[model samples]
Target chain A: MGIIKLCGMAGLIITGWLVGFKKSADLRFRVQRLKKLYEETEELLHRLQYEGLERDRLLLSSFSDFCLVWNGKILFNESGLTAEDAVILKEMIQKLGTGNLETEEKRLLYVLERLRQQESAAQKIAVTNGKIYQTLGTCAGIMICIFLL
Target chain B: MKEDALDAVLPFVHQSIGRVFLFLPEETKREVCELRLRRNLPVCLTLPQGIRYLFKDGTIDDRPREGVLICTAEQLEETFFLLCKRSVYAHAEELREGYLSLPNGCRAGVCGRVAPDGMVRDITSLNLRIARAVEGCADSVVSAEDGGGILIAGPPSSGKTTVLRDTVRQLSKNKRVVVIDSRGEISGGTERPLSLGVNTDVLLIRNKAKGTEMALRTMFPQTIALDETGTAEELKGVEESFHAGVQIVTTAHIGEKRELLERKITRHLLASGAISTVALLSGKIGEPPEIFSPEEL
Candidate 1:
């Protein structure tokens, strides 16, 4: 009975070791895949920003890569990226690497505001100049009438 | 950042900065910026992807496109000193100030407070304009007959130099060509000319005024090519070249063929039977080039 019990305990320990080893191998494979996906994402971002390609096909391919890595998660995750989040991630990657759209809108707004300020300043200058011109013209006309009379 | 946002924003940077900001690696950017500022060339920062876009779109060609950035007086001075080191063979005093020319025919126009001695001794400021050379543009001027003087006329940046270079290349195939490059525009030669054919010889006279006279006496060329003929003495030299049995190919800035014929000096040269053909180049570079001969217009 003792010998049989010892054999049973040994078999349990062996089974546990095999399960742990299998899990480790799976985890290693997953980590490597994730690393590859990250590198690919970086390369794609670099290429897209440097090489302006408006082709829909390339965009779709990039989107797909993001999809696989993120596992459909479109938002940030503590563990890793989710698939649905690929589109958003791809968009974010583009903005950071190239330039953000929000920043651009702000820049455009700043320019427009500046132009408005300049236009107002110009109008003020024009008004001042026009007043002087009108005064000069009126005096000249009066002088001409007096001389004629 | 969003990719769409980045894409939209990067182009503005390139437009504002006026150079390919994207494709230049970070290391290259630092080096190029230093070189540019040192040579009085302009520099700008852009996303790497934007450069790729320009390259893919054909806005930036395979050949090197020189550029300059004018931000401040200090940057301009740095660029000027660097350019002086690269191009001028003599001492700083011997070299003319306020003008910086690069190897590829791109010249920067410098403007600053001039000293009393007619030197830009102080150089308080600088305005650097980057010029680029487009090769293989001179092929259109070739005629069926070999030996005749051809006049190329155009306003600034009307692809005149591009066409002139192409014409020289074509002519260089058979004839012995000698170019008196006042600004080093025709040869597109930086250190040495890459496009000027084996038969072609170039005299880079960065300081000389009398190009035609120098070509006639010193360089025994079958054909002479030069840029910007603007004086009565230079016109006389053109006549001299004709007298010496040398075919003359030169350029001037004018509006049209009629205007060219109406000019007293041009008329004199043409009427004297020195010039046989006139090539009037119109439109910008890479567009459909329109060529007009004197007889046609």
Candidate 2:
């Protein structure tokens, strides 16, 4: 009976940790993806102006590794992202693809800065939430196990 | 005309619009010169002669067809944004010049309010001019003029660029040709399948005057070609090209030889004996070639 109860408790704790870790992993991926997008955009803009690469090819290739947006359709890397962030990110990318070079550069800098702030803030929230959810999950499992006993 | 060249713009449009557009009769596609988009207005296809409204269902309403589904603000925005590749910021040079040059060498002219800092905003209309590189039509020009700096004059859409493009190709057979393409229309780009001939070097710059100087100093070619040499600065560039011992083959937006001497700009270029021979294209574009070359006045 005691062995069975211990097995049940272990299962609960493992399930809880897995769920919490998955959530935090998604948050980290999103932040990394956003940062990659920012760096790629800056590099791509330079290639466009100095190298005269075609815009469509540059945009499509810049994010091919991330697979974030394809042919105007947004493909989010992490399932955890909200619909709103995806939409906003698409808009920023679209804006980057059009306009005069100077204005575009300025606009992209603004977007990169905005993305940076979001990344930082998201990182903080992710860290906090990850800690909270993980602890809450483990504690709940222990409480449930005690109750069963 | 390259069929796939149309693909550069197909992705941004509504499926209905593209389907209907692609379904256009071959004759319609052949003659289509411009596509106009106005917010709250029906999208239109401009032929050389008349305007036809394009319907979503792949049917065109000839001029008399009154009621049609007009373009929405959202559709216009999407199309414009797509044409700019979702970034109007990169085309700042074109935006300030009031047009965007697509990859296929087509030009989209945009109209909108200018922000305080000169940024274009609230674009309400986009006019796309489909430019193609047609080769054989200019063969007659090369055969017509023996080696000399030639100038072509005609009214708007008079195939001036067409003549220039073909003439450049023909001239490029043996001569090293450098084209100062202020707009992408002349040769599209060095990479485009649209051949300006292998011996040709193209400088796709925005300012014709500056481009002329750049070509003269660096390209080191036997001939320098450009389109629409109208401005005073452009005329100066013409003299510079002539003085450099490089033949300047270019076009002007004018009708007759007399008008060439009458217009202050053309007159200066001609009076200086800068333009050796002038080929005037009279017949409508796409019609059999009828060039009237009046000896330099």
Candidate 3:
């Protein structure tokens, strides 16, 4: 019975830590994806600068595809963003669609910097709090085991 | 091309506008020369026949005020943004001229407030002048025997650039032609070169005078072409190139050779034997371009 209780405790603690780490990894992936999208926009602007705007709209439409893919179900509400994060993301996309490259670049750099900060924060929370959660889960299981005994 | 003509602005405007444009009978899209938009005004299309308003039901009216939808600020902003590729800084130099030459050979003439510093600060209206390239329009000019050079004369929107472009393409088949594209209108866009025949080079330079000198000095082109030459500087450049034994083809905003002769620099150019032929063109909508030589005049 003691062995059974120990195994249960180990499972709960490990699951808690793994879940936390997975959430952080997901956030990091979103940040990387967003940064790549930003680079695509930068290249579009660079082309627009030297080559000129095409009337067929091929370039802008291509960018729209990226936007659609980004907003697709896979990314929807999965970045673990808080309310503040959602607002920022919405504002950034709105500005990106506006077509002002200089402003877009500045805002993108700021966004990237912010995302990096958020990623670090998420990672810190994932690692530090994950350990805390694991420890708490183990303690709870131990206490329950004691009670059972 | 007609189907995707408004690609740059499609993302920003409502679907209603796109539907109206897309639903435009294929015949009408080909006939229309411009898509005019103004703040708080109905979208007006400049057809070969005349100016008309577009309705949401895919019908057009000559009334001009019967628009079902208005041109919104968002649409205009997006158009401007996309036109400049969202890089306002890089386009600042060209924006001061009150017009943007897009890649599809369309010219968007903008009207708006001007800052004291001379940059076009705010835009109120945009007239997208659509270009229709009639492939064989320059046949007469190309087949002419004169090796001296040809000057094309026409009023504004009289398709001078179209004729010049075709002429260059045809002449470039054999001659080493160099087109000094002051505006992207001639070559379509810098990145995507239009098919300017087999042996031709296009130099994208906004200043006509500077472009002429640049072409003469470096290109060693058998023929040099410039568009809309009325200034003294352009005349001098053309004269110098002509004297250097490089044939010059160019255009001017004039109704006839008499008007061109009345001009100070052109009179001198003609007298000096630099310009051999003055080809006057008057092309009506849906009609073949009628070219008249000096003898016809």
- Compare the candidates by lDDT and give the number of the best one: 2
Candidate 1: list runs displaced more than 4 Å: A1-149, B1-70, B86-97, B121-135, B144-146, B206-211, B287-297
Residue pairs with colliding backbones in model 3 are A99-B86, A101-B86
**In model 2 chain B, which range of ten residues has the least summed lDDT?**
B288-297
Model 2 / residue B241 / CA error / Å: 2.1
* True-structure RMSD, every candidate: 29.0, 4.1, 5.3
Per-residue lDDT of B34-81 in model 3, one digit per residue for the tens?
A: 788787688888876787888877788887554465778777665666
DockQ of each candidate relative to the true complex: 0.01, 0.47, 0.15
- List fnat per candidate, in order: 0.00, 0.72, 0.12
Superpose all Cα atoms of candidate 1 onto the true structure and report the RMSD in Å to 1 decimal. Answer: 29.0
Tens digit of lDDT per residue, candidate 2, span B208-246? Answer: 999989888887988999998889999998898888788
Candidate 3 docks at the CAPRI level of incorrect
State the lDDT at A29 in candidate 2.
73
The lowest-lDDT stretch of 10 consecutive residues in candidate 1 chain A is: A93-102
lDDT of 1 by residue, B143-170 (tens): 5334788878776656666667767777
Model 1 chain B weakest lDDT span, ten residues long: B30-39
